[model samples]
Target: MNKYSVDKLPRDIRIEIAHKHRKLRKQRGLSQTELAERSGVSLGSLKRFETKGQVSLESLLKLVFVLGRLSDFESILKPDENLKHIEKLFDSKRKS
Candidate 1:
């Protein structure tokens, strides 16, 4: 596996995501307390996530939903368009 594979870089990715979330929260003019109240997430969880990149999926979803960016998560785990096309081609060949 490559030294920079996804499995090897989860920590980095999480930190980056935390940074982006913090930036967006500030851009939206929401303090941590305000966001936590609006999103139904605990202020502790939000602070931990912002400072340490540690948060549960449900809490993260609630935060993003309150930030108006929940739709961005919909594409996660979906097949890539190019991969889908390649799979379709293989399926057609196998059925022939």
Candidate 2:
């Protein structure tokens, strides 16, 4: 199997992301309570996310904003380079 195949499971990805977020929070010396207060997310939501990787997008964004890692999400769902090239080709064909 290819390396990318291992990441096909959303559950795995969510767990990995949660682990990374927890590590970053610890590295920054912020406890869960402190982070929740600063990010305006409920402590219950934060705990759920840390333990189960379940969080709403808005809450996750708020948490990341407080952690200064919101920019990491900027590239998600971006158009692929190959898709852009194909779109350009189609545009040129349509203009002909």
The per-prediction CA RMSD against the true structure, in angstroms, equals: 3.9, 3.5
The ten-residue window of minimal lDDT in model 2 covers 1-10
How do all models score by TM-score?
A: 0.77, 0.80
Best by lDDT: 1
Residue range 1-96, candidate 1, lDDT tens digits: 237564647788889999999999999999999999999999999999999999999999999999999999998999775688898899999999
Task: Give the Å error, residue 32, model 2.
Answer: 0.5
Q: Candidate 2's residue-wise lDDT over 5-92, tens digit each?
A: 7545788788888999999999999999999999999999999999999999999999999999999999999977668878889999
Estimate the lDDT of model 1: 0.94
Clashes of each: 0, 0
**Predicted structure 1, TM vs. truth:** 0.77
User: Which residue runs of candidate 2 sit more than 4 Å off their true CA positions?
Assistant: 1-7, 84-96
